[model samples]
Target: MHVTLIYFTIFFLDFVTHAVKEDSGYWRSKARMEIRRSLSYEWNTNEAKNVIIFVGDGMGPNTITASRIFRSGETSSLAWEDFPHVGLLKTYNTNKQVPDSASTATALFGGIKTNYEVVGVNANVPLRDCEASLNTDNHVESIFSWAQAAGKATGFVTTTRVTHATPAPLYAHSADRKWECESRMPPNATRCKDIARQLIENEPGRNIKVIMGGGRQTLKSNVEATESDPLDAWACSRQDGRDLVDTWKRDKSARKVKFAVAENNEQLRKVDTDQAEYLLGIFANSHISMDWKRDQGPKGQPSLEDMTVKALKILEKSANGYLLVVEGGLIDFAHHRGQAAQALRETVRLSDAVNATLQIIRTEDTLLIVTSDHSHSLAFNGYSDRGTSILGIAQRSKHDNTAYTTLSYSTGGPNNYAYEITNNKAVRVDPSRFDTNEFTYSQQAAIITDEAYHGGCDVAIFAIGPYAHLFHSVHEQNYVAEVVAFASSIGEYGNKENSASIFAVDCILSFGLFLTMLM
Candidate 1:
């Protein structure tokens, strides 16, 4: 609703042209559809029963725009773009201009910005020095903890390992994000705990109703891996000789807690929500496969949409409602590899997960937020035709008679960095050597580096439901957690008028969106 119309003029003209050619009644039909939206746009002032946050890692404005273009050529929007409230925020960390996931995710979930590589701890804690963080006094609790204390079921789902930086802050507290398992701890940091141990043994962690994702090796030994022995050829393996997965199951059995564990998509689908009190699903020994590599057979993990649907079913069992975080994390990794085709496909898969979540819950009482932790340096260039293939070469660079695609990154990957540095992209490359449209092909980059870098730019936050209007202005990244806590009537900002304020903002934002769409 708060989006700019100028940026969408191209899309608007395309629709109008089609309508005029199809039938004279098409315009009238479109007007009635807008009226229906106006009716469905009412704001509910009552306390929200649920809050879901959908995060797209490394999704920036450039990333979104390029993805929109590549998805179907002329389309200019995704599912979240239709939301009633949208705004941009600065993503800088307290100590660095371009923040990493540890600090940025901590700010979003803990409501306090800290130094780089610091997760679920305050700014007073130094990065990677666990000796200085041996005590519990330095731990910073995230919003998930607040939800648990309030008697609400809390959970998180991501394509990355549940012990990864983003999800770790939701439940685990450590001096460093890299301390994923007991064996990974530094020599002098044995006094402290690893993130995986904390997740299965600590407060909010043990109490969580659902924990799903990859990281089997972080808990089970590499020898026990089901899909592949020693699992992904690219992932780290556990070497501590302890089977924490079995230990976790033993603890649950001794406590008489009813639980279900699934290793593949088929097993997860058979879980009966009515009978199971807890669910644990780990699909890979490391991070789950990317969208291109996803196979839903007996040996494969569930897709992002599959995971969201299952998580929602488990969480909705609570009468008090729930708070769940679903993250599409591999967009960052694909970008790191300079694979635009792969990265854009991941974003589309993320959008599919968001749409699936919407089908299970009504928007009137639920607060849904879709955003990114940070951005990559990927961008689109050249003024080609509106409906031209987004992945097709738009022009032959004057710098060298070599052709270039609309999408390219600042730096990263072998074909991009090494090929460019060695020949300066001036080797009169054969167009047939690589197919930009192929799902596995790597995209192009400008400079040379082993991995792409995060960008120092503002990222957009799209929202719908109560109190979303409070996010209209440009603000610090930490302010997002404050707005979420206020809307849900939790934490320090919980008060008598919280619901009233939320209702008021809903009406205002809906009206603003209506006017913008009319223009």
Candidate 2:
């Protein structure tokens, strides 16, 4: 009853707001679009020529439910939630029960469960042990290598730095997830390579046709203030005096590989993806701004939707097909800071990116999978009224006459250095005074610790395309790569080299066997 009342109230409010601002045609058009979306659903069983994976870094079931309820009382579903195949992915790493991005990434992209904090390596290697990583047996191939080997274009897009844990596993094999640049690497580990360097120097990593995200500080010898959002600047500037971006450009030039770097909205608009086979766009120095707040700053950042469309513009040029991975990685970053509003906005941005990408591709021929690297510590509690602002305090706790937020994290960043949110004796606030819906709002966190840890829940994987039905059962996270590999006929699953001829002979033998039985 409470939920129904809340929905009706929100719907009425929205109607009034739209009545004042938008024309009647807007309402008619929106209804038509919604109907079209429902009618467009189809069982795509055709062999996938292209594969696109969208990773919502910390989106667990709780995150999805919270997002849905927050938007309105259960009336809306995320764009990808309607996908034909939804599976629960077991995310425990090879060593740890609650895995981090690097380990989970190796499982999803490398098709193997690796040790915690290690990226693109098998379980044979230990974390941060530089020497152990040098063994050839420790190295593991990723989706990028398999795609490239099969003569397909490959790329990845992320809200985090391009060399961050999630995207790094696509091409980089690092002993330490912290080894993003030379400055992060130890002098003793000379043989071990950092992520940014490997991204430029390694095989399939260097050969990536579309690389878009932040990490300008890691790529440059000196960090310059860009008069935009200060968050775009990184604290750990490269001290080695080697400009990796310049080196990358020189290498591409020497090899005659066409590439362009689109660093901002203006550049992104100007980059002619058709003229260039390779593109690298780094918009920020560290991680990019949160999606909703991105436009508020003077610094121009392209929306995830814009970046996805641009990537497809280039990757679509490949006649053999392409493999692209998109990461809404900042959702995890915000959750660690105990920022619920930011996380929800990032998740919404990812959904919008998926919806936009769907507009440009044929669903039957494109295998699209949406999943998360791991779950966050964000929790929803209290007997909050349904439709209570997701970030608002549920009416004061009758027990102590103190109010608590409907949304909160279990732990926080160093005794809540960034923001304080304690459970037992939390500072109460009047929800009426504060705008909980603000994008910059950081929700309350229950515990006071150093960085909220990942939750040990099975994140969801939503799929649409050929063999998507294979994801019907609950399975280990590594099965993700195996299913995609088999569907696309790449890597070890590349039995298609003579599969057509074998099928024809089997059919002929079936017919000939009938005559032999009669004889």
Candidate 3:
């Protein structure tokens, strides 16, 4: 009986030990997964004292690469490449594969995916529907509005007119993004409403702190008699009838809107920052000219970097930090014109702007985001070495040491010209119907490339500072709003950090996959 009892006791002990081992393994696995989720969730929830979103309108991966080559020469990386974090972002709209600037900018500002050509409204509505009347009228709010509500200073700065689509998303809520300036019949006052007016009237007493860039004429209807509307003839004007400049002399709140209206660099430099909390600076009636065309000293247009730096200086003064939006708005214009040289130069200007902002940002406390709304159908083809001239197109044999003229117009036009169509071989030519005058005047023959004639391609996205890692993986255009909201430490996740380099790993994997395919 004693022997039987001992064997039974030993068997029971063994059973207990085995069960414990199995349970421990299962718990460990569960714990590991929980930790990963926690980290990722936190990675999406970091905060910053200031948020700076730098937009390179119409920029793409190739555009960034070419800009890097242009700025640092063939071998150097872009200034922003040194940012400690990086991530990819998608630029698609809900209804269209190819998105317009209006809807894309709306995604960034409103955190909602919208359809093409629509602005500040959700995607479900009909194209002809007005955004102001949509049921979502109050449900969808812009980042600027959120920042304002949070008591943080907010500003919008760009090379485009203040009323343009890229900047409109921040302050204006409208169905039609093209509502630039309203007009009426010859006898009547311009009765139509525009986005610019909506922004100015949105909040009567709240001060936005800093409003800069071109668009003087859009704001004023009344002016002293002059060649142009005397009121708006200045680079900047306070059309609200408050005479913010005079108020700056007396009233405290009016003084807060003290502004500088400069049409050139000279006027920009003379503004007194010591006296004003809110500023309005316009350098031109429309978008500023290209950097190459701009003059230096008092006459030249300000570089994107100059505008960015100035904007930060004003925004950082807020005790509660600030949200600032800066745009290199002309890169899109260059792409629309199919001028590669102009587009590349504008991209370099954007890189310079990013570099300037990063220099001022010390704490991983500030979140800096750089991206484009969508990509243009642009590409660089042909096999070339590192130092090969990007300006010229030459084709070299993939495996052998032979070279041929790789860049020429399939339409039998000059290489310098841009045509609308491309042949079966991926060569470009102008569509027969388009007037020659419509294309920019070029002395050289036009080359037609298949890629140039089409649309719908992935754009570029890059970010740094807290929670920026959340931008990784395939995501929607609204993901940008999520990332910004997360990084601001505003919604869902808050005060979390991502030190795991998961995003970095993903980037590496993507690069390797691309190289593997090439091999």
Candidate 4:
């Protein structure tokens, strides 16, 4: 027995030694490289001509760390991890400690913290109060409106419905986030327009150069399931019977602007971005499927990276620059279902989209901000080996000798009750007996509930390009919109006279420093 134990120990040590590249010189060289880059860094203070904000709906610090490990290895970094500026955002809304997407999105896009379930409106309007929402004084403008007012183009892309909570605040003002269509609204709320209608009839929405993502059923009238409407056969139709898609096309036609619509991947690829001034692409009836599932489904939908590249191609034609919002919306959905693997994969896809954008845009003129609307309850646990798989088991519990995964949630999930009552004591089911890396597998949770909840922790922010240095410290969530507005010289902070005055002062200070250096 002693000889066998000694042989197994030797094998384990040898495996670990080979798995990790732990040469002291390797780490020292990497540290020196990072130091050299930092010492030679120069701040970009140029005025931003274009802005792109990439939001991972439920991606928190923990999720980012796990994704970095899953995508490459323990020491690997995501695309945005190399950004020069990093900060933390306080994501609480006025009404809740642990906020939802709607309120947080409103803060990020509208520059104000509002109540939960509210969008594009101030805190003065109560949630679900249709009369309160109709008051123009209670409404707040977003970055999209600012961009349009400044003669800059604007657009958005998401993995979920275009009118979903995370993207709705950019163009829609509603008392309730659920009011995506008239059918979803209460009968008494006749004065309030549905989110889809706002996107078609409102100022910034109607003028938006590009719109993509799901929610076809909300935009069209009642129709039977056909080859075209395969995904949303059971989805609820618009109660107003007005085809918003047709409305959008007619409005654009009246203005005599070049416009195009695409319902599938092939149609989208066929669009002439150079000629089309307006574009709309809706590939799913509701939220788009998870990345892996979408790949296995019909070949109609485009990946998030594909949509992002197309949007940039169209938006880049604007001579005055553009403001675009891209969302990895499915990360939140996957976390709610307790699918840690799916959530991490979605985060990686968001990173892929960011990398693609970096390839297409010039960082000298464009400001790119990558952040999260909120965080999930997903927790990273366990003391695994040097190069253990992120989805594999960590260590066994000493109390019961049951294996637990590296990723688990704080509360709620299908795996919350994954135990057996034996002899009046519960024993956690051994995860080693099955494949925990399956896409459908749910990580264990601390408590049993219908769904996992959002975490109250602050999320991370990464910035590059012009004015990136503004995000060097912790800040409120609304600071994000403020930075975008200030950098692009748009919104209330963007008057020609004020900008000139600030520029003059900067020049005076710069000249004084130059003279002192000469002395």
188-270: candidate 3 lDDT, tens digit per residue: 32333456666665551135677777665565544343322133332333344543323322443444555555556777676
- Which 10-residue span in candidate 1 carries the lowest summed lDDT? 1-10
Per-candidate Cα lDDT values, in order, are: 0.79, 0.81, 0.62, 0.88
Question: Could you tell me the TM-score of candidate 4?
Answer: 0.90
Per-residue lDDT tens digits of candidate 1, residues 81-147?
7777789878998889999888889888988888898778888889887866665677777888888
Q: Which stretches of candidate 2 lie over 4 Å from their true place?
A: 1-43, 226-236, 296-299, 414-434, 497-519
Off by over 4 Å in 1: 1-44, 224-236, 418-433, 494-519
Ranking by lDDT: 4, 2, 1, 3
How does residue 279 of candidate 1 score in lDDT?
84
- The sequence of per-residue lDDT tens digits that candidate 4 reaches over residues 1-519 is 232343344345444644668799756865775676566557888889999999999999999999999987776678888787899999999999999999999999999999999989999989999999999999989999999999999999999988889999999999999888888788889899999999999988999999999888788877445543354433346756788999999999999999999878888889999999999998877878789777433356888899999999999999999999999999998999899889999999999999899889887889999999999999888798868889899999888788999988887666655677889988787888878889888888888788899999999999989998899888999999989999999986579688678769989999999999999
Better of 1 and 2 by lDDT: 2
Better of 1 and 4 by TM-score: 4
lDDT of 2 by residue, 220-286 (tens): 8677755564534333557688888888898899999888988888888888887989999998888
Score every model by TM-score: 0.86, 0.84, 0.70, 0.90
The list of candidate 4 runs beyond 4 A from truth reads 1-21, 223-236, 296-298, 499-519
Candidate 4 lDDT for residue 241:
75
List where candidate 3 sits over 4 angstroms from the true fold.
Answer: 1-46, 131-139, 184-192, 204-206, 221-257, 396-454, 491-519
Task: Say which candidate scores most in lDDT.
Answer: 4
